[model samples]
Target: MSLVVTPLELPERWDEPGPRGDAFRAFHAHAERSNAMRFGPDVVARSPEERLASLQPSLAEACRAFVAHRDGQLVGALKVYTPLLESTDVAEIVISAEPDLPDAEVLDLVEELTTHGEQVAAGLGRGDFRGGSLAAASGAVTAATGFGGVDPDHPEVAPLVARGYVLEQVYRISMVDLAALPDLDERLAAARAGAPGYDVVAWAGETPAPHRAGMCRLKEQMAADAPGGGVLFEPEVWDDARLADFEASAASGGRTIRTVAAVEGATGELVGFTSAFVGTSTVVNQQDTVVAGAHRGHGLGALMKLANLAELREHHPNHTRVVTWNAEENRPMLAVNEATGFVTVVHDGVWKRRSVS
Candidate 1:
């Protein structure tokens, strides 16, 4: 199979009022439709008007869009960032061909893009170009691209592994569902029967002023417990402004954040907490759920999860299904998810690469 790859200037291809601009939008729509499991329906549901409004600013700044054509037909496309402030050089490549595309043709397309990426990085005085979600079928492309492995859990890791990339870091993705969640009242009653002194309240995002200090401490403790966790981030990490940004982002995407906390009646210390985000797609992305070490074995985790699901159902009545991802090794958190009615629908591994030369 023969293919032609071309570099597209963002302004020329994606700017307002251009033929190439329309093509770019159509390309993304096709990609999202073909890869629904990866990109999700929210992206597929984006109208052309919405796409233009949402992507115009980013295109003006760091967009590098490319398209692959075979015999005058568009076959594949990629989008890469051009060294922004928050990112050195992050890139994502999407292929629209049928899954049956030959390995050789795919590798050829990857090599073409990698060559362009190297040129772009060098011109910007950067040493590496990072790509995410390389997929299991793109092993040859990863090897040909010369990107070293950074993390195995990243979506791109499996392909990198097939090409000899080493693991750098591993992070866990945890999740829960709302539809099958246990009855919160039943769990609360059971907890009350066992430990009548503790007060369990659903966090309505209106965390009480008195419990703020305890919540801060719990946040710090959870961060500290992160496996291979790095230097402690400042309080600003969980400050009101940052939390508000999170809330706003979720709201914009038609998702709701629910948290439930268990507090000690005597000292008002926060002992356990669980948080869930209900997305427009009905997938409940479990953000963080933890019980402080001092409060383990009290069934507080289940109580919080149950409460969050109940509140989510109240707010978002249209949601029918939810999904979450967790590391295969998180026994405690996995136990809570299992008890609360979340089952694994898909298992994905993440991969990363750094300092590709």
Candidate 2:
């Protein structure tokens, strides 16, 4: 059967009862199945309602989605996120298909999705493209960063390689069971004591007024300081407006934001911070954790993380596990995570296509 590709008509409310709502739900279900096949059975995809709630757009980025059908059955999807910040020249695209399809069918679906995604991006004046996917670590195709590799034979990976996308970096997806860590309190105490010059502070929901500017600065620094390997990303620009938009968007999506920060005791400035998203599901996502360049070596990263995990426990007690991704080359952050009970579950390959111009 011939494949039909079309732009997904996003609903004003994802729950509106109609053909659009049905398509929305089916697309998410297909996404979940694709993730399970690409990663492993242990990996969990976001629930449809949870995914819909979090589909937020902001001044910094605009999001779009497309669905593929064959014989009126939803078979594949493509999403594009165009950055409106300093990296406006590039956009990120994600494409997925229903699992267990024949190899030929899968390739055709992926190829069409890629061609469509590029056309949409180019129309928006985006020349560079970024994407990520999970792949088994069994092939000779190594990331340029020299830290991780992915099987080129993997169904999800081969199409990208064939289309000239280069593997830039590999991210290790780690998970930690909240209930399994019996010594969290002790670890928090040690991390706090080690950072004598810094004090820990935390909050649930929106950023407090006094810390908004400082948080913005830390966010900007996070984009600049985090290890990107060969991926091209200009530092993000965050201001009061952007922060407010972020909080509102998260709230609209039914996600509660929990944050912990390290304050320099002498200056009372927020030099480092970490945040987690507690959504409608049981999983807690460990978001950005960064310490300013001058504030490194004080164990601030670990300190903030431990404090945030404690906050998650106290406020959102029903969480099953904390999940985070880090560049495989980032040994310091990985060390902190492993010591705190996180184990590597899978690896994600970050791929990029240089400007087509």
After superposition on all CA atoms, what RMSD does each candidate show versus the true structure?
Answer: 7.1, 1.8
Task: Go through the candidates in order and give each one's C-alpha lDDT.
Answer: 0.53, 0.82
Q: Write the per-residue lDDT of candidate 1 for residues 1-357, one digit (tens) a residue.
A: 567666643333334667667676656665556456454554224444433333433311355556677787666666655534334543333334424456566565555555555565566655433443433312333322232213334423434455543332222333444445446567656656676557777755545677666676676666556332111122222455444444454444234567778888797788877666554455555666678898877777766766666666777666544555544445677787788777544333333344456
Query: What is the alpha-carbon lDDT of model 1 when measured against the actual structure?
Result: 0.53
Winning candidate number (lDDT): 2
Given candidate 2, what's the lDDT at residue 290? 92
Candidate 1 at residue 195, lDDT?
63
Q: List TM-scores for all candidates, in order.
A: 0.63, 0.94
TM-score of 2: 0.94
Give candidate 2's error at residue 55 in angstroms: 2.9
Task: After the best TM-score superposition of candidate 1, give how far the Cα of residue 72 lies from its true spot, in angstroms.
Answer: 6.5
